[model samples]
Structure formats: C-alpha cells, structure tokens
Target: MVGIWGFIPHHRVLEEDTILQQQQEFEHSIHKSGSESDVVESIDENTEKNDKEILISKRISSDNEKEHENENNLEVEIQDFDVDYDYVPYKFGEKTYKIREIRDEANRPWWKVFDEFEYRNTKSEAKSYKWYKWFPEGTSSAEKKLLVKLDIFLAFYSFVGYWVKYVDSANLNNAYVSGMKENLGMKGNDLINTQTVFTVGQIVFEIPWIFLLPRIPITYGLTIAELFWAAFTIGTYRVKTVSALQAIRFFVGASEAAYFPCIHFLLGSWYLPHEVGRRGALFYIGQFLGVLTSGLLQSATFKNLSGNGGLEGWRWMFIVDGGISFGVALLAFICIPGTPAKCYSLFLTDDEIRLARRRMKKNGTDVNQSTKALFDLPTWKKAFSTWHVYFLGFINILGFNSNNTSSGSFVLWLKSLKKYDTVMINNLSTVPPALGILYVLIICVGADITRKRFLFVSLSFLLNFIGNTILAVWDVSYGAKWFAFCFGYWSWSQSSVFNPLISDFFRKDTDVRAVAWMAIYIIGLQSSAWIGRLIWPTTASPRFHVGFSTCAAFSIGFAVFIGIAYFFYKNDERRESLENGIYLYNSETGDIPQFVLDHPEFVEKNRYD
Candidate 1:
C-alpha cells in the first residue's frame, strides 16, 4: 500500500513541519517499539537493498519526496485561496489529486480533503476540479500592480459617475425656479407631486436593482443606467406639459434607482470595512461637486443661452448635463473593474486577484459570492433584528427631511435672498455644500484613520442642530444669511461621514441596497414634508420656526439614539454576541449576555450559542 504521506510539494512543507513536530513527540515510541529497524529491513529486502544501506537510503528518499510535495502544495494553496473548496488530497495512478474532505469511514475528520476533488469516481472528480481553475496562468509580482491599478481606476470612474448623478437632480430645482412651471403651464404643488412620484418609483426599484447588480455586471449595468438617466434628463428639457414633465422625471428617478446602492456595494467589494467610509466619502464628494457645478453651470448658462435654439437657458442646462452624463457613462464601460475574480480583462492578473480576495476574506467577508440572498430569512433577521438598522433608518430620515427640503425649496428660498441675481444666487447657493463636502472628506479620513465612527457622526449631527437652529432663529439682517451659508457648509460636511454609517452597521456587500435605503429615507422624509406644509406652512418661509423646531427635535432625538446604540454596540462587540441580536448589556458586571436577558427563550432551552 502507498504511504499516506503528503502528495503535493507545497502541502508537504506545511505538513512536513507538522509531521516533524509530531515525530519528535513520538520519537520515544519509535525507539521503544524496536520495530523501526525491522520496518527498514523489510523495505530494503523488498526493494533488493543491502541490509547496511537500508536505513540511510529510505530516510533520504522520504525527505526528498516531502520537499518536492511541499513546493507543489504551496502553489496549489496559493491558487485555491479565493476558490472555495471542502477537500484534501489523495494519490491515484502516479498523480496526486484533490478529494473531498468527507470521510468514507465514520469517526474520521471531514474537510481533511479538499472539497473540489470530492467524488467516488474519476469523472465527478474531474468536473469538481474545473471550478478551481482561472484564466491567465501563474501568479507574479506584476499581477499585484495591475490589481492596484484597477482599484485606482474604479475610484476615478466612481468619482466621475457620482459627479454626474446629482447634476440631473440639481437641474430639477434650477429649472423649477427658472420658469419651468410657467413655461409649461403647470400649477399647484405639481412639482412636489412630480418629485414624490419620482421618489416612489425609485423606492420600488432600488432593492430589485441592488439584488440583481452583481449578476448583471456593474460595468455594463451602471454605464447603461447612467446613459438611460441622461436620456431622460434631456427628455425633461423637451417636454412642454406638467404631465409630460412628471412622466419624464419619474422615468429618470427609476433609471437612477439602482446606481447609488450598487456603487456602495461595488466599493464594499473592493475595500475593507474600515477602508470603506473614506472611499464612500470620495464618491459622495463627487456628488457634492456635481451639485456645486450645477449651480455654477446654471449661473454661466442661464442668461447667454436664454433663447438659443428657441429653448430657454434652463432647457440648455438639462441638455448639457445630459451630454456630460452620457459621455461619462461610456468612459466607465471601458474603465471600471467589475470584481477581483473577473478583473483579468483589465490590468489585473490571476495572482493579484487572489491576493485581493485573500485580504478581503481576512475580514470574515466572502467577497465574491453572490450576496443577493443576504436579504433572506436568517441573514435579514441578523441585520434588521439589530437596533442599528432602526437607528440608521431614523438618522437617514432626519437627513432626508433636510435634503428633500433643501433640494426643493432651497432654490425658491434663494429667490428671496434679494442681494444675488438668479444667476448669482444659483452659483452662491452651491458653495456651502461644496465646502461641506470638503469637511466631510476631512472628517471621514480622520475617522477612518482613528478607526472610529460614532463620535464623528454624533458630533456632525450636533453641528447640524446648531446650524439649522441658527437658520430657524436668526432669519433676518444677514444673521440668517450667514446662518444659511454656515448651515449649508455644516450640513454638507455631515453628509460625507453620515452616509457611510449605513454600510458600517450592515457590514457586507449583500446588505447594500442603496436604492432601497434611499427609498426608505424618502418614505420617512415624506412625513417631514407632510408635517412641514402644515406646521411651518409654506407662508412661514424666511422664519419657519415650526419647521426649525421640528428639525431640532429630530436632531436631538438622533443624538440620544446614536449614543445609546454606540454603548450597546460597543458592549456587544466585547462579548462577540453582536451577531445574535443582543443589544443591551449586563448592568452589574457589564458582561451579561444580552441573549439571556432579551431572548429568555434561548436561555430556557440552554442553546443560545
């Protein structure tokens, strides 16, 4: 019978070290048995060796085989790092091949064999082996650089796409103030209703898009979605009726739904958990820049092109913005790397892909498996069961209340500023958010470097409370003006760090449904509009104390909620029970299992673990 020694060279080195240690421990056994010489004598006689030469020859052959197997096994291990398997190896017909780790005999350790090569027959074994192979042979140092380049390229592509994203939305507000309703014979809060419809469409599709994103190939899907939204944006410029305008905006919102969530998921796939928030900020900054650029573009184009081609300057704004979106969409198709596994078409090679995959896997995340089902029973329970989900949703609702209003009413508010022209107001209005984006980047970078999130987010909300409070209380005599400007800066700054917190708690690519999350935020935010229209009343503008008071209330509520969550979550981390829905901590020792307190059923059965 063949000895069950290590088969592959690389495997042998690891096993060699293990076996050598085991041999040392068992050395006395070999000497005590007095059978070592007898076994050596048997092998020598069977192989026609002289009695005196038996011991040294056998020892040298065994060592040589072990060394050879070690090198071969190392190569296999490196290649299999990203490929999932449940097997070890065995010998057959002069070749070493992998086999499933499952045992043919009871009481044997399963997973000792590699799962890929598991099979009772040669055909099944061959089929299993196919999955481990990748295109582009052998890993090299050059492949590492290529993967790094791909990461950089993705960053730049995301930046450009993010810049294009909010331009269309910003143009909506710009056009609303620049005679869109009048020119199209629109009336009522039809614009609000249109935005509502657009948001509804977005909510309906966001989750679906995020679920389908990985299967669809982000490079293709995102590029097409961008182009589709661009077409609808330009379509907005062509429409002449309220119904038509509403229809166009609804389509634009629907097409844009999957984008933000998919981008978040994509970034997560490429980055580590701690690394994600800052990259998230980079993409977000592009969005802030887009909003800022829209204002600057509107200021520059509104007058000179007022009647160019018989279309108003606002129409040209839509047209130009759409053109940019289309251009960037095409660029992304060529540049973006979908995932490390299939990134070979770009600069990355097989070895680099493995390295990137290994680094991500070290964080306990399965980087490439289709996470579409993460919303399924157990996982969703794990996610939504946590208080983090509710608090995050509430925090976002607060953000939405501010954002939706700022998106819709800000231009109208700026119309009342008196000192700036329509063009100047548009241009100046974009600055606070642009500056705010800068603050967010700085804060996020610092947060990431420090490996902390709650403090930054809490401090950010506090600043927002102060800024919005100033906006509410000081409405006249440049006090409100300065307040508005400062509020905008602080408001934008908060956004950069706050957005990534959603991903922080969720902590997986599959948990990312940006469109769905946004939809949830919008749904919650709609209440703000409902309450705002009644309490503050549209007529209460310039000094809407009620609106300000409501925002302040929510802001304070968020601070308290976040503080409580941080405490519980931090405790949960210490106990390693964060995964099982235990939020509160032990009072006396601070070491009590939340499962025992909250989930008494689990304790009664004594199976909480």
Candidate 2:
C-alpha cells in the first residue's frame, strides 16, 4: 500500500477508490461492445462468457491504474525535492558517485593560496581545490591512531639514527680543533683531506648500499652499519698518522652512507606525501641537535676530561660519542620496523598491520615489488631520464655546499678571533645551528600546511645569498659579521624539505625513488668534497672572501633551478592528465573519472596537485 512518494498512508486509501473507478469504466466499455453479439439461445451462452470476461478486465484495469498512479507520484516527488547542484552524479558499472563540481574560483594561481596561516584556518570545501589531499576530511579515528603510533615508533628512531650519524661525523672537526692536530702532528689541509676521503668512500659505496637496502631488513642493515661505524669511531682514538685516521674515516663514511637514504625511503613507504614533510624535518632536527650537542660536549670534555687517564680531551670525545652511538644502534634493532607489509614490531596488533598495509596501498605504494631491483639497468635509466633527477640533484649539491660554508667558516672565524677560549668557541658555535633548528621546524610545518616546497626552497637560497654576501665583504662591525655568519645556517632548512619533495615526485616508482635518493647523497657528498675544500681553504682562515662569493653565486643558481624544476613538474602533470583523458575546468574540483581511479598507477598522478 506504499506509493512512490515513499510510504504514504493516505495514498493507500485513495489508491483503492481509484482502482474501483477504473474497473467500473472497463466493464461499461466491455458490455457496450458485446451488446451487438446478442441472439436468442446464442445470447444466453454469450452472456455467461461476457460475465467472465468482465471480471478478467476489471482485475487487469485495477492493476494498471495503481501502477500508473505510482509512476505519477514518483515523478512529482523527484521534481519537487531540492538536489545539490554542486555535485554531479556519475555512474560506472554497478557503482554511483557524486563528483564535486569544479568552480571558477578555484583556478587562482598557486602563490595566491600559498599562505600557511590561511590554509590552517580554512576547512576544505567540496567544490574547491586543496593544495594537499593526504589527510582529507572523514578520515577515520583508526587512521588517526595509526599515524600517532607511526610517529612514536618509526619517526622516533629515524630522528635518533640521524642524530647519532651527525654527531659521529662532526666529532672529527671538533676533535681536530680541540687537540687532534697537536697530538697527531696534522698539517695544513690534512683535516680537509680526511673529510674528503670520507666523502669519496660515501660515493663509492652509494650504489652498492642502495642495492642492499631492499634485500635486507632496513633495521638489521641500519644496526650493522651503526655498530661498524661505532667501532671505527673508537679506532679514531688510536690513530697515530693522518693516513691511519683517513683509513678509519673512509670506512666510517661507507658504513654510514646507507643510513640517510634508507631512512628517507622507509619514511616514504610508511607516510603519505603530506605527512612525510614534517617527519623528514624532524629527522634533520636531529642533525641540528647532534651538531649543537657535539659543540657543547667538545667544550665540556676539553675542560673536564682533557688529561684524565692519560687520554687527550679529543680522544675521550671520540670514545664517549662512539659508545652512545653503539647504544642507539642496539635500540634501533629493537624499535625500528622495516615497512608496513613487512613490519615485525611487537607493539602492533594484527588489525593495525592490516590497516597499515591497506592505507599504504591506497596511497599508491607498491609493496609487492622487490627492493633488489634498485640496481637494474632499466630502473636506473627510468630514474636518470627524468628531468627532476638532474635539477633536484643540482639543487642538493648547492645546498650541501652552502651548508659546508657554515660548518667550516664559522668555527674558523671564531678560532681566528682569539678573544674567546677554546671552551667558549665550541659553546658559541652551537648558536647558529640552534637558530637553524628553529628555522627548519617553522619552514617545514609551513610547507606541510601550504604544500609549498619550491617556495620555501627558494627562500632558503635567498637567505644564504644575503648571509654570504655580508660575510664576503668581511669589513663590517664584529656584531654585524657575527649576525651574518649565524644567519647562513638558515640554508640548512632546505635539507628538511628536499627529501620529502623528491619522495612526492617519484611516489609511484619505488625503485626509482630509491635510486633518486641515492643519487642525491652521492652527488651532494662528492660535490661537497671538492667544493668544500676550495671554498673554505686553510689559507683563507677568518675571511674567505673568494669562497663566500662563490657560494653566494651558487645560491642564486639554486633558486633558478628550483623555478625550472617546478615548471617541468607542472608540465608533466598537465601532459599526464591529457593523455589519461582527465578533463579539468579548473585547478580545484574536478571529476575523478572511474577509469582513472581503477588504474593503480594513475591514482596519485590524478589526485595530487
């Protein structure tokens, strides 16, 4: 007794009346037609047959009238109800979806909508474009819990691992300036040579380590590398010649080379593009803290432990830093899980593991592929052929070079001042990197909110250019020169942003992502080895005008490269959209056609801006 207007009680009573009226009309028509067929005896038999025929017609007419009334009611209801004009219904196969309409207001330039403050306050709208879609509205409570666990377990280790790596590497500089030079009879540029040899080791082992990354569990690999490097760091205390120290440093660099790229790759495997930026920044913050701690440790050890147990203060620094590294290595073995699909952490439940795998797959991760393919020639070709590889690689090189100027020149300048004691010099050196930590944290949070990687990177280069320009002049007041030197560390913020940006660019290709990350470190380290020594030579001392000027020019070049890379990224996006038949009226809202969503490879390319 339900009408098409949806279960109307009054319509059920009215329907019975309308059915009876239709039946009466049908009987009248039938009787009128049969009146001409009447004869005496024939009419008697025909009357009985006519009665049966009228009953049949009455039932048929009643059913027909009810069906017609239902159709009319449905039509009236549909026409009267309000529907959302902003959403268009699309049907594909057995499924239906409501696609938000693309509006004209969403077509504004990226720069216009690139404010972090505004993006934080604004809620995402249905018909508008979002700069980042990693954390869309309607994310379940389960997903929020998973992200928190990931930050606690996976992100925490990455932070500690990076911290230990930087502290170990920087110990050489601290040791050399403290007492290693006097103890080991090291001469001009010998310290630089040791660092250069270490960089060479990193370049040599880069490819081999990347190949090994996928074949072995990342946690095991990281732990083994950490243990070996820790041993080599302990060996540094026994070095009697520059060659001995150089040999130890080389192995240290080789073992540590895998740590950075593998950590970045692991982060990408677990987190979405939007989430990876902040995590990557946190990892770099570890490096800043390590640098800061090394300075303070060096200052304290020089004062308190300089002659304890017949060991030089520099030797004790090596022993203590190495011991801490070994302890962290043991902790990493316990805490770090490899990847979502392969995670063996005791902290996770079965349901959480399944949820993690499903979420990563939805985000376009291919967990089934072999990590060993990182060395395949075709995979290498695919990675190298991309324009992003060259442009981003060059940007990393410039960034590392700029960072080296801060590490080398600032300490040398402090040493040349001769006003502060060794302890003050070491303690004072921590200030710039401390400022760098703040800069990196703020910029990375903004980048995540605004989804503006290239913009922040450009700004980092500008800061470097300005800071270096002031240092190159070298004629300003002491306070002015000091401020300029400290400002240069702001360039380090680019480190936190670049890795996540590259990961986002190559998200669909795991092997390519691994190779690209390796290339970044290899090129950066190798370039820094040669370029760092030339820019901050022993002869230059307090004011390396030539080196600072060269770095300033490189900073401008880095900014230009970033612009070109962004242009190419947009071009690729547009070309892919056209080839895939994804028509877009504006930058914001658009129909995500079923065909594109069904294809696994096209999912990220279509959805990500």
lDDT digits (tens) for residues 1-609 of candidate 1 = 112432211111123334343443234334445566554455456653455355455655676587455435433444333322433333435855343222112232354232211122122222332222321233344434544575477767777888887787777777766767678876656666676667766666665653465456677677788888889888788887888888888889888876776666667566664555567677778877887888888877797888999989889999999999889878777666676433413444444455566645533344543433423444445555656656667766665554323434455667776766777778766866667676777666655654456666666667677766666665456656555545544444555445555554454444443333443444554455455454444345445566666666666666677677666655545343222211223334555543345434322121111
Give one digit per residue, the lDDT tens place, for model 2 in 421-509: 87888888789878878888777766776667778878888888888888888899999888888777777777767777777677666
lDDT of each: 0.57, 0.69
In angstroms, the error of model 2 at 552 is 1.3
Per-prediction TM-score: 0.67, 0.75
Residue runs of model 1 more than 4 Å from their true location after superposition? 1-151, 186-188, 341-345, 371-378, 492-499, 508-542, 577-609
TM-score of 1: 0.67
Q: After superposing candidate 2, which stretches have Cα over 4 Å from the reference?
A: 1-136, 371-374, 405-407, 578-582, 585-609
lDDT winner: 2
